[model samples]
Target: MTQKKPTSRRQFLGQTAAIASASLVPFGALSSRVSAQSPNERPRFALIGVGGNGTRTAPVGQQFADLVALCDVDAKHLAHGNGLLCDGKADLYGDYREVLAQDDIDIVQISAPDHWHTKILIEAMLAGKDAYCEKPLTLTIDEGKLIRKVQKQTGRVVQVGTQQRSSMNFFNKALAVIADGRLGKLYKITVGIDAGGWSPEISVADVPEGLDWDRWLGPTPVMPFRYLQDPKKDTDRNYTNGHTHFRWWYEHSGGKLTDWGAHHIDIAMLGIAAAGQNNDPVSVGGSSRHDVEFKDGVPMQDNRYNTAREFDLIVDFADRDVQINIRHDVDNGILFEGERGRIFVNRGKLVGKPIEDVATKPLPKDAIAKVYRDMPIMGNDRDAHWANFTHSIKHRTLPISDVHSHMKMLNVCHLAGISCRLDRTIHWDQTTEQITGDELAASMMSRPYREGYEIEM
Candidate 1:
């Protein structure tokens, strides 16, 4: 649990750089890589889902690991990554399974859609590859459970890209306020994640050339490609409902709930822990706005964005006497109100009476460290998040955004999404991590994968 803070960005990079240049060291006798590789050799990584974020991640990943392969179902995206991220030399594939098949790949970085995250990550670990995956690590509550099981079985190191926890000093500082008792008995958390983008009527369109529409819809049901032509260029992908536009559909993602929720909501749970409390909610219920009508959480129409465009969810922790309201109208930050005082934080700034009082009333020196569970803030968010992952790969320890904590918070987000879909309050038996009372609601916790793509849990 103890980690030394890197003195400088240069020093951190130098240490990470050693992973690639250093001589091979024993990863373990049990590793499949025993003959061909070691734990110390620069991990050869396969980047999956090369979209906008994947392109941005490539350069950062290369600073610590080698990018030897890339995969994306859309040929256009694959080409973009090939030219820009890999300079056309990394072996490219349309199927991620193929990339995982390569013997040389020791690591995987997944930026795939939320629906695909669990399957890919579980397989990567079972295949003996450690990985780093983007946030909202699971599409459903069951998915998170399945992933936790696999992680424990495989003993693979994985990190979730919930950057706010790493990059935003303000966020951790806000958690410190509670840990330091600047906030007297914490009572409520108001999270303003805002709303998802709205889309107009989408028309069925021919699948774009070089894109495998089938594979892109991997685990979701087969549906026609739908899109709205660019208003200006007549070539945009804005409302396509796949590729760049999948987040708008409940079939692919939880919209802003998981999109931004994975970031802020995850921090909110840590804030719960900072208050010396557990985060299991006894009841989750809320109202949400969908562009289309719904019957039992299933959208009645297909042409419009179906995920909640706007929502307000209430998560109650009855045992702890705490409540969290995830709303669209709150300022786009977490407003933590306690009996003593209040402080608000997002990626930008941390403020309020508690923060102001900090000038004179310094927080407990170990407050932030306690919330982060002892990992020293390395450098910038980018430096620390990545550094923590690479450091874990070398030390064979869990990274900062380890699967366990990430999934625990993510389950709350998934539960909220289910509540939005069903339009009713659902009780949770936190002891079993199961939905209680409503069978229909309980069923929504996990979806049956389209036949061929089923995950082996």
Candidate 2:
């Protein structure tokens, strides 16, 4: 590793002036002070899971780091992602472990399925690499704990792919207004996620030619391949889309609860945190209706999707004053209802009288910067998340979406899924971090991994 030179007096004064102007929080406790690297010394990056989301994030990684390797369970996906790189020059691999085995890669991007996230993230950190993992960071509540433990042990930089954290318009602006007390007293938060449980009826068929199905199903139970052909092109044998369709299954994902819940729930928790409320919910209860019948939490029909089609969940915080209601029927977004006024935010827009009032009654000058943990507000720029991750790796600082807060938010999503699955109210002991009373509900917190794929501490 190259050692960075000492900062000049002029550079220190400039940094001091920037911090003073932004009204930024002191970074002494939030992150470590490591030597910053030069632009010419860009880190080497290896990307795993070149499916839809993976393909999208690859170019972003290219913008900050050298694209050294691309890995995917499907050969066609790997080839496609590699082609998107600068002159298609990076090496390609069918297995992610092979990419991690290399000593030169400094950053690993895990954009795989929800089930594979924890395993890859842990292995990447253990291999001495910083990571940028997509959200719904873990498949279960237990996985989140394990990832945090490993991250602490390794001291590696990890940025969860909850891009909203870096967005200036929706999340940043919303938090700024809330923190400024524009919305007098936040009483309730409503999050609406997309409805799930649509799986076309299909028969068992052979795995496609270019895909390594077993590897793709890493950590998931071994099951027969269910053929899913594109409705538009009936004869298309390529099951690329089908391979990534695991999100609809409970075994692989928590449906829309974790899918969109990861994003909305995160912002909800951030709002709660900004308002000086405990981020973790103490009690969660919900009811769900699935397209297929579930027996002992497993769907009866394996041929079609099993996750809930419609559901409503109510969450109570330790603060007692704040309550969260999650539903499937409403449009996909978050609504924060407070004593003074309410605001609604999603990927597209952030609106409400409170937000509108900011024109005449602007936030307390540095409120936006404060919401971003003292960083400058980069409005509507999607690349800010990637930039933050890379900047953290270079400076050894905590990015906006650090692992600890991400896990806390994910816990709420997982609890909601478990409650909806059992159709009962579940009590949670936040101090102990366990589900109370119902042993069956408690068991859902973590899952038994397949023999070779279990997450080892």
Report the lDDT of model 2 for residue 62. Answer: 79
CA displacement after TM-score superposition, residue 144 of candidate 1 (Å)? 1.2
| Candidate 2 ranges with C-alpha deviation above 4 Å | 1-37, 230-242, 376-381
Model 2, position 180, has a per-residue lDDT of 88
Clashing pairs in 2: none
Model 1 alpha-carbon miss at residue 365, Å: 3.6
User: In candidate 2, what are the lDDT values of residues 331-412, reduced to their tens digit?
Assistant: 7889999889999999899999999998998788788789888854443455888888876766677788999889888898
Encode model 1's per-residue lDDT on 75-173: one tens digit a residue: 888777888877788888777766665657788999988789998898777667789899879888988888887676666788898877776478878
**What would the TM-scores of all predictions be?**
0.89, 0.89
lDDT of 1 at 306: 89
Clash count for each candidate, listed in order shown: 1, 0
